[model samples]
Target: MSETRSDSTPESGRTVNRRQVLARSGAVGLGIAFSGALSELFAGTASALGRSGYGPLVPDPNGLLDLPAGFRYQVLSREGDRLRSGEGTVPSNHDGMSAFAGKGGSVHLVRNHENRVTARFAVPTVEGITYDPQGKGGCTALTLDHRGTVVSERVAIAGTAVNCAGGPTPWGTWLTCEETEDRAGTNGYTKDHGFIFEVDPVDPHRTGAVPLTAMGRFQHEAIAIDPQQGIVYETEDAFEKPFGLFYRFLPNRPRGGVGSLRAGGRLQAMRVPGVPDLSSVQETGASFDGIEWVDVPDPLATRTPVRLQDFGPRGITHAQKLEGCYWGGTCVYFVSSFAHSTEGSAADHFGQIWRYDPAAHRLTLVIVFGPDTEVQLPGESPDNICLAPGGGLMVCEDGNGAQHVFGVSRRGEVYAMARNRQNIGTPEAPEWGEFAGVTFAPDGRTMYVNCYTPGTTFAVTGPFHG
Candidate 1:
């Protein structure tokens, strides 16, 4: 039996299946703001060895991708370049990325290239390509040193569907995810896209771009694995009228590792457990920025992708867009691209950030874009996020048109880190939006960013203050 809010009780931990994604996808174009799509189903890319945003400091009382000072940046990869592995070069637009610990340390990163359209490129022997006609919009795993240099690179997971935002594993691996399940039938390309894939940092050979179906299939954004409990948390990326659902998977093995997640266990969706109404959400188009959560069923041996309505009523809360999800200290913090249902129009489209504390088992609103905080930073669409090893939260702005990187201090004081665009405060030219793929050096000193379009990597270092 499926789970819903009506019969949900602390005693009954039913089964449901889903995942959460932090970095947003399908929402950027040259200089166009794809935000409306974020509320619906954003389709979103980077560059650098040919980098785009370079040179000196730009002032911004408005604060756009600001840095501490005395720090410089460089381009590591270009939109069309040959990889060290000598495989297929970077596809169209590049998205999300992860950094491993250590300076001069070899870091493994998985980037999203939203090449929805097919292109002319050389193919590798061992790799695969899905929707070859749609081009190859998947994740690429590459390695770099501490000082910001590409050591080695390869297609982490190829031949899948729309490859979107993904994160790194605590155990030294990358979790690459597919953003949609568009091709379901034979004509739908390969049956491979739409699952989480684990990529090797030092090695990309033989691991074939495989999808972990045990993680369920639908529209996936980003997923975070809880090292302590070996639980995988995921968010469904949907513009399906009402909104998408948030999920958590309890692997068969507790206190396990990433490989253990493949073992499978109980998959559950969220609901307000005791309050059915708390679970009720109307056709919000694409949202739930602050609607309270209701408890749903747990993943059972005989379960499948279940809609959220069973968990509660119909108008209690607004379904939200779940982007980035990182395991911070004692809680899981995620961001939403918009506030309410944007399946309707632009007016209801804004953004919000939230924190889910497993300890107290509560979801609280941390920051709301466009409401006060965002005003300080216009066009700020909070997407893929990382916890600063120092003491703050690093937020990558995935905007419709221009994107910026922001450093929100522990005290909620937000500062600009790096901008994908050329000019900062003044009207810029290079158009920066989709500022994502952020991670700190193992020492928490330097930061690396990814430019999906043009496809490039950047490094930021300095005596920082946030």
Candidate 2:
């Protein structure tokens, strides 16, 4: 973790303290108004209390996941578990994922493996869907019945690298992103990496190894789609000093079904007139109006990286660790996992959640996580995020110490929903891994999440609020 920095912004009058932002949650529409299960979370006053959610979480007797008393989790898949297809075992480093409706009332989960060339278990390279034979990262599909029992699992796409966080499309497809900018011959990769690939939940054949180049070639993290205009919003998770830029793609064929993004689109990076670094602004409810989008001169990054490209005098805005992204209500929600002044960020903080309203051409800071002395707490570096079926938000912690899945209620209260007790390390050194891919089934009955290390996926069900 980085040292904490001053929570001051250059702009005046627009900045508000975190406490004030929570107190005026209703006035600023703090809660997300997304459709379906993603409706109202963070609408009321925000509370930093730990027990405000479903009460204290009870320890699990199985030495796996600890949840609240009434809630229970079933292990759907593990890293080395053999796939039903017999092609290979489940890959390592399970990251971004999304759940879709499957055949006969089942649920189909498309998961990503953040594997590199040195990974032990690589996503099996199926003939037609394999992109680059040397690339060691890709996605897999898991099927769970209504009873939350594993039905079948297989490889969705293969021959990619560093498959990190991605988002789902309104047209029932999953967009898997590669968080890398490695070239073909650099890392033994036969093809250029760092592009988004669309995967169809039902049919693996539909998702060939074609990368959506029009979506830009950079260290892609996650993406969210606007259903109305079919605009695709993307986040770049570049670890370099310049950090990454937020992008939006205007697809030629707006909302077409599968394989539409491959038709090519105009990619653009976001720019806030005077704001060059997002971390510099620490005030909650800090809204930036008149947000501008600059067209990328080279989306392919054939010469210069997208973030380094010239974007006029008022260059594009950059954020460190730009991770999880989702489309809710009429706006797009994104997360800057964390920032460190030591790492060249303008400031330091735990995390931030920003809402971009396309209709209003405005961007507002809905939530700002203050520095936490205890890294094991709920409000640390929040990575992947999703809406709870009942209401509120579910966040994955990627900070130090104990890792947990936190729930933020409609009133903005944060609580521990689940904890990972799987000790992948030795008993003398007990190390717990971070959580990722927090999503809910369409029926709102089952919640699915992933454990990054030792790579495990679990389906949790209980008396949810919805």
lDDT of each candidate versus the true structure: 0.54, 0.81
**lDDT tens digits, residues 304-364, model 1?**
4344335445422324466787776566656666644236322354565555556455554
Question: Cα RMSDs of all predictions?
Answer: 9.7, 6.8
| Lowest lDDT block of 10, candidate 2 | 29-38
Best by TM-score: 2
Off by over 4 Å in 1: 1-68, 102-104, 117-125, 128-135, 186-188, 273-305, 308-318, 340-349, 371-379, 422-430
Estimated TM-score per prediction? 0.74, 0.90
lDDT of 2 at 311: 77
Candidate 1 local lDDT, residue 123: 26
Best model number under lDDT: 2
Error of 1 at 107 (Å): 2.2
The C-alpha local distance difference test score for the whole of candidate 1 amounts to: 0.54
How would you encode candidate 2's per-residue C-alpha lDDT over 46-148 as one tens digit per residue? 2332124565677787889988888888889998989988888989999999999977788999999999988989998999999999988999998888777
Cα TM-score of candidate 1: 0.74
